[model samples]
Structure formats: structure tokens, C-alpha cells
Target: MKNMKKLIIYISFSLMAVVLFSGCKKSDFSENYYNPEKAVTADVPSLYAGLFKNETILPRYWNLYTFQVPVLGTYTQIAGYTNGSGVYEQPNNYTGDRWNDFYKNVMARYREIEKHYNALTSADDKEGYKLFLETAQVFVYDQATQIVDMWGDIPFSTAGGLNAEGKIILPGYDNGESLYNTALTELKRISDYLATVTPNNFYLSQLKSTDYVNSGDLLKWRKYTNSVLLRLAMRISYKDEAKAKSIVQGLLANPTQYPLAEDVLDKITIQPNSPTSSLAPADQKEIWNGFDVIPYPGAKMVNEIMVPTNDPRLPVYFTTNKNGVYNGVANTLTEAQVAEGATNFIFSRWDSTTFTYNHLLPGILVTPAEVNLLKAEAFERWGGGSAKDAYEKGIRLSIAFWYGINNISDRVEDKVEPPTEAAIMAYLAKPLVAYGTDNLNKIATQKWINFTIMQAQIAWSEIRRTKLPVLSFPNDPTSVAAPNPPTRLLYPSAERTLNTANYNAVKDKDNTTTKLFWDVR
Candidate 1:
């Protein structure tokens, strides 16, 4: 209890500390954002490093325990939950945490970088810092995309611009589709600019030294930028198929111009490192949650799906039970049933080395599997290329991606070896695992299985869109909360308290049951 309190306190202070430079709230904009009083000025490299260090992409304590496990993870069945009261409720503080992290930790540092780029006088002068400016924009845009997907409309056009504007100003809520369009437009421009723009030796050396995410590789940034565009393009597909189809087809049509992270090795991940050292993915544990309770593999995900199909990622995703076999908790389990399973050690828990305790787990942004899966969907739907080829390649890459992650992190517990080519081929040939029968279900199911709890947010969003690997939830008749999972999260209560007028604009769409514009199925 004491340690839990300390963890909460540490997280509380950490959240407060980061926001000293953000204006997610109108009042915070005064002490937060850029106060000339605080002397927050720093070079582009320093500010870029600061932005890169945030653990939004990592499987860390706050994001996992506070947000994913309780909300998105349960909603998508990536993490196990029981039939209980308040099963699908989105807590105000938990949703607010993500909002705060983006505006303060992410956008605040980004705004500072923009401020530096904006200060430059000449076009040639701007050229020196252009790489930093544009690359950082890709990251911020990606995070913003996730935020908009979670909430309908957000303060985008003017969220953290107090540094740029140099005054206290309340930002307005921008339309979600409009925000998507803005990011898509700028992402393409940035990718095009990088394709031709060459940085001189001096600035190149500076970027190489200071750039935490891509190391001085403009090609990686270009791939990452286009990949983010692909994600957003696909996300809006059902609601706005015309725009989605054009972007998806165009990206796949020109591989050289719009290169994607199409191999397992090309995952955009940040490794763990110290503050004084280069930026890395911090391999920290989620302290507040019980290891025994939360990460248990879902009943259908393990027993009904992976076990039947012989998934290579099975061991990486979960450990065998005491009976020396894999099993997941049944969704309909009562408190007694859950207790019985736990007492008997019958349920497969998440693999410690690859997930829970692995110190080498890097923060993931984009992956080859994700890009290829998107390609598979695009080709399968629009028919510019071979869908089967893309689909098979995506499955192969997903298996290899987990192996790559495990191999990179030194095994503390027993290591899970990568499967052979023969095994992979056989798995793919299986009647249940094979492509073609219910192709959309196959695609969506594979994507969801590969995502696991590691990419909970994306897994949830994708599942909501595709409604694949269909699973059921038990009703909590005694509970006051909704019987089923929510379509979206409720906005944080703080938004109404601090940013009321702006919050009111979005309040009409604030109910958790209200679907986003793209959720049309």
C-alpha cells in the first residue's frame, strides 16, 4: 500500500513537472508554455531530445496501468477483465493524463522547436534547422492523430502556441476530420521536401548528433512520415473512402517515393537510456497493477485462436500455465472461477522476459507489419496490387517483429526462440490460419493478434473499425455503468473545469457511446 501510494505520488509529480511548459489548460498557459520569466530557451537539438524522451509509445506504468489496462485494453480484450461494476467506464483522470501528456510533454517541446525554426531570418538560415522542424512535426502529428481518434474534436490549431503567440490565449476545438486533413497535407509536403532536400554537412552532423528518434537518417524520417500518413489515410477509410482510397493507392503505387517500414527490422522504436545519455525506451514496470490479475491472456485470444492455429508469438505473448499448457481466463468467469484459476496457476500470464519484466522493450511508433497490413487491406480492397502477397508478407513480418524485440532485449527469464521457416509456412497453410476464407476477418484478426497488449490503443481502434476476431463481454446487471464497451472515451472532467467554453463545443459529442466520424461500418 505504501509503495503504491509512492508510485502514484511519483507519477503525479512527474505529470505536474512536465506540464510546467504546456498550456493544455487555459490557466496553465501562464506559468506553462514559454514564460520568458523561466528562461525555457534551448537549441533545437535539446528541445527535440526532450520531446523524444516522453514514454507515450512505451509499455510503461502510467499508460498501461492507468489507461490501457482499465480502458482500451479491456474494451478490445487485449487485457483481461472480469464481470464487475463499472466495467467499461472511462475515468476522467485517466483520459486526462493522455491529454496532459500530449499538450505538455509532447506539444510543448515541439512548439519550442517550432519557435526556433520560426525565429530564423533567411530561407538558407531556415534550411539548417528544417530537418529538425519537419521531422518533429511528423511525431507531433502522429500523436495528435491518436488523440483525435480518441476524442472527436480537440484544441489542435492553437493548443500549445503560447510560446509562438507570446500571450495567454484559450484555444478552440478543431474538427477531427479537419485536423486529420491538416496533418495529412503537411505530412505529404514534408515527405516530398525530404525526398529532394539535402542538408549541408554542418547541419547534417548536428542532426546526426542530436536527433534521438532517427539518428541523422533523413530516409528513416521520410519513411516514418509517409507511414503515419498511411495510418491516418486508412483510419478514415470507411467514413471517407474516396480520400482514403486515393492516398492508400498512391502510397502503394510508388514505393520509392513513399517508402514504408516494410520489414520487421524497420520498426520505429526508442531504446532505453539515461537522461544524460541518448534517448531510449524506458523499460519500466506498471507498479499499480497486479502481475497476477491484469496481463492474463484473453480466453478466446489464447485458447480459441493462437493455440488452434499454432501462433509463433504465443510464447512471446504469454507463458505456459503450471499444467505446462497455455490457457486464458474465460470472460464469463465469476470471482470464484477467477480465484480458482489463480489458485491452481491454470491461466497463462503474460511472458515476463518479452513483456512484463523485459528491460529491452523499446517504445514502438510504427512497424513493418503495420505498414504491410495496411498495404494488404488497400490491395485487397482497391486492387492495385496482389493482396495475398501483402497479406502473407505482413503475417511473416509480424512473427519476425516479436523475435527481433525478444532478441534485442537480453533474456532475464527463459528466452523464447524464433520459429523456423518451415513452422511459419505450416502455420500459414493451416485451414484456420490460411488467408482467403473470410479475408477481412483474417486480416483484422491477424492485425489484432499481432498488436496484443503492447499496442493497445491501435489494437482497440482497429478492432472498433473492423469489428473482427469477434469476442463477447459478460453483462454486469448489478453495475450502474453501461453493459457493453464504449465507442469512445469521455473527455476529461478538467476540460469542462478549465477550458469550459472550448469543452462545450465538443461536449455535444462527449458521451462515451458517441462514435467518431470514421466508425461507420
Candidate 2:
């Protein structure tokens, strides 16, 4: 009993000393310490690095692969492969760590960075500080909007608070509509702030080393900001046409103020230094060797779509099978059929030389193709310029992005040539591929194809919003949890146990069938 008392006293004294020392050398605490995993204060450079670190921005390729390819790809019919293990056989069974990753790892650190940025006074380099703050704000809007997009009615206003005193253990949910509106407002604020600064300014030069996304190129960051704003505005266009149109028009009216992704060079992507540095790839084997999420071109995508249209992207997007043909596997193959080798159904995987072999390849966040396509939709709905012009431009840009001038080499075995202008014109002139008077379907379909493997999540979103390029699972109705493709992912089960009351308020509505406010199909 005496020994136990002495031990307790020693621990108490140690903790007291730690507290006293921490308080006395608060400057040391502020400067030396940097841990994103915990809710501790970190320097701006460290925070910036944390934000772009593979696990933060792109995240573990497997987690994103699970969410993008297995789940969204299956739903959108971008990828198809048979798995009898029932891992991704049903919507209910489809799971992703994105919810936890976004909230805890990504958003939590973002909040900390914001808090640190806000704490800076005018005594600091005000211009440089503001630039940093604006950049952080862009991330805040991006991350928050993504959260709202994925799971409706998320805890936004009161989500990531320092729980040192345990005040905000259970943050309440904010309605998706309000959160989206808030995000738009925030983006506008960020854009306006970015406009006040120039890329060549000394303020931006300070951030060049730390800004992993754009290398402190304020202009590119601004363009990315405007592009995100355009994306968000379009996301709500179906539900809130007037507001969406107004925002879209305002941005389009002033290209100088709101620079969009006009060219492939302007596309938002992170070009990693090495495979270990980013989630690109160490070798082709790292991509093809993994069977858990091995992806093949969907049957409908290849046969009903690309083959018929003679899409030039076919060679760039996929590799030929053992039979030297670009075949595709159906998602609805039965367990018995899978066991029987599924009729030797070999399908195309992602072009290893173009993608997997290149370790320095950029991990795309948003593409110019996507922005131009969005522009096409906006113009189609509310005429600013010729919709056909935008549509053709979008298609051409997508082709150029993939095949023309990105400098990525083709597979030696495939001998695929870069798509030429004549070929692009010829492909676009096809009755099926050509832009009609009301070519929303054509535009959406092309966008879907462009997004394959590059931005599959956004492709899923486009499909959910427009229901274009109709996807069907011909066999095994039992594999699906609903008649239609799932609208939203079920909230992570951890929320129920961690934050019971708030989780209960939203849990009943949190199912695969629940459609987001923007998903008004």
C-alpha cells in the first residue's frame, strides 16, 4: 500500500511538471511539436504537407480503390469483374473507410490548420498569411463539400473540434442543402481572397516549397478554386437551378477573375516524385498483382459503347486480353460460373505502361475534360455560348488529355498511336457520338468514359445525377440490394456507437437507398 502511494505521487509529480514545463515553454510547444494524427497544434508547412500526404489527399490507393472501382465503378458500370466472396456483391455489403478517413484524418487536420492560420495576428506577414489562409480555406471547402456529397446531413458546423475538454464529442448533423450553400459561399470567399494576390508575389513565393498540389502557383490554385466552385454550382443545378445558374453565369462571365481548367496543363493533379512519395506505382506488378480489387472494363462499356463508337480511347484506357482482343467481363457472373473460370472470360486491365509503369505520373484530382464537360452542360441548360462548341471542345480536350500531348508513352506491345485531329473529328462525326441539338446524353456518356479510372467517383456522381448511359446488371438480381443502383453509401457503423444520439437522429435515413439532395433523378 505504501509503495503504491509513492508510485501514484511520482506519476502525479511527473504530469504536473509536464504541464508546468509546457506552459512555461509554450513557444517551444508551438514551434517544435507537429502531429496531425493528434489534435495538437502544428506549423503551417507541416500542416500543408499533412494535407497532401498520400494518406490525406489521395489516401491509401486501396481505400480509394475500394470506394471508386469496386463500389462506384460497379454501380456506374465502368468496371466489371466476378467476385464470389460477396465483398462487393451487394450495396449494403459495400464498405469504405473514407468516412473515417475524411472526418478524422483529413478534416480534423484541416480544422487544426485553419485554427492556427486564424490565430495569426497582423504583426505577422499579413499578405503571406492571408495567402496561406485562402489556400487552407480552399481545402476546407473541397473536403467539406466532398463529405456532403458522399453522405448527406453530415456534422459540418460543429464536426472537428479539439476534444481536449470533451465539449463537442457528439456534433450534430447539418442539412446537405445548407452545407452545400455554405461551401459555395466559402469558395467564393476563397476566390475573392485569391484574386487579391498575384502568383509572382513574394507572399506566394513563401508557400512554393510547401504547396504540394500547385507548388504555390497562386494562379493554378485560383483556377482550381474556381473550378471547384463551378463543380459545386453544377452539382446543385438540377435541384436549385436559379442559384446554380446565377453562380455559373457569374463565374463564366469573368474568366479573368475565375480562371477555369482551360487546358490539360491546367488540370489539378499531384505529380509525385517517387512511388513511395505518392500513390502512383512502384511498378506495373504493384497494380496487376492485386486481385482483391482487380478491375476490368465492363461489358456494356466496351461492347455497347466504345466498340460501337470506335472510341480511340479504348487502346489508351485498356490492354488487350490473352486472345489479343479488348473483351470485357460482366459484373453479374454467378458463383458457379466464376468457379468454372467464367468461360475463360479475360478482360482488359488498365494499360500498365501508360499508368502503372510510370511512377512519376500525376494523381489527378480534377481534369480539364470534366470542367469543359460541365461547361457544356451549363451552356446546354442556359445558353452562354454554343453548347455544341463546348461539347466538341470537351471531347477534343478529353482525347488530347489521354492520347495527344501529356507525354505519357504507350505500351511497346500495343503500338497505339496518339489520337490525331482527323481521328478525333471522325470519331465525333459518328451518329452515335456526334453532338445533337439536345446532346446531354452524349455529353454525359463521354464524360463517364473520360472519368474511367481517372476520376471514377465523379463519374458515379454524374451517373447518379443524370442517369445517363443506362447501366444494367443482366443476371443475378440477388446481388443488388435495390432495383436501381445505390444512391448513397451507408454511413459507417462506428458513428452509431461513438455518437449515439446524433447517429440515431440520422441513422434511420442513412442507407444505400437514400438519395442526396443533389441526386434528383
Q: Best TM-score goes to which candidate? A: 1
Off by over 4 Å in 1: 1-41, 122-124, 163-165, 273-293
Q: After superposition, how far is residue 141 of candidate 1 from its true place, in Å?
A: 1.0
Model 2 lDDT tens row, 1-521 = 01222122211110122223233354533332244323255656567656665432442355445566667667778877563444334443235355655664456556656777777775545555667767877876776777677678887677765468834445778888898898899889888877885543655565886677888887898899999999899999989999999999999989998899767688787766555653455444443443237556677888777878888888877777778878776666765654354346466766665554444456566788888889989998899988888888888878777763224432345445777788888899888889884489888988998887556667777787888877765444445555445677776665675667887888877876888999887
- Which structure among the candidates has the greatest lDDT? 1
Give a tens-digit lDDT track for model 1, residues 1-521.
11232222221211223233332454344333333223354566666666676656755577777776667778888776776667777777768877767776677677777877788887876887888888888998998888888887887777654545555346778898899999999999999999998888888888886666778888888889999999899999998899999998888889899888887667787766542233322334442242434768778888888899888888887889998999987778776787788889998888877776666676788888888888888888889988788889999999888877766655545777899999999999988778887877888888888887767789888987777778788776775656678888787776786678878877889886889778887
lDDT to native, each model: 0.75, 0.68
**Candidate 2 TM-score, C-alpha based:** 0.85
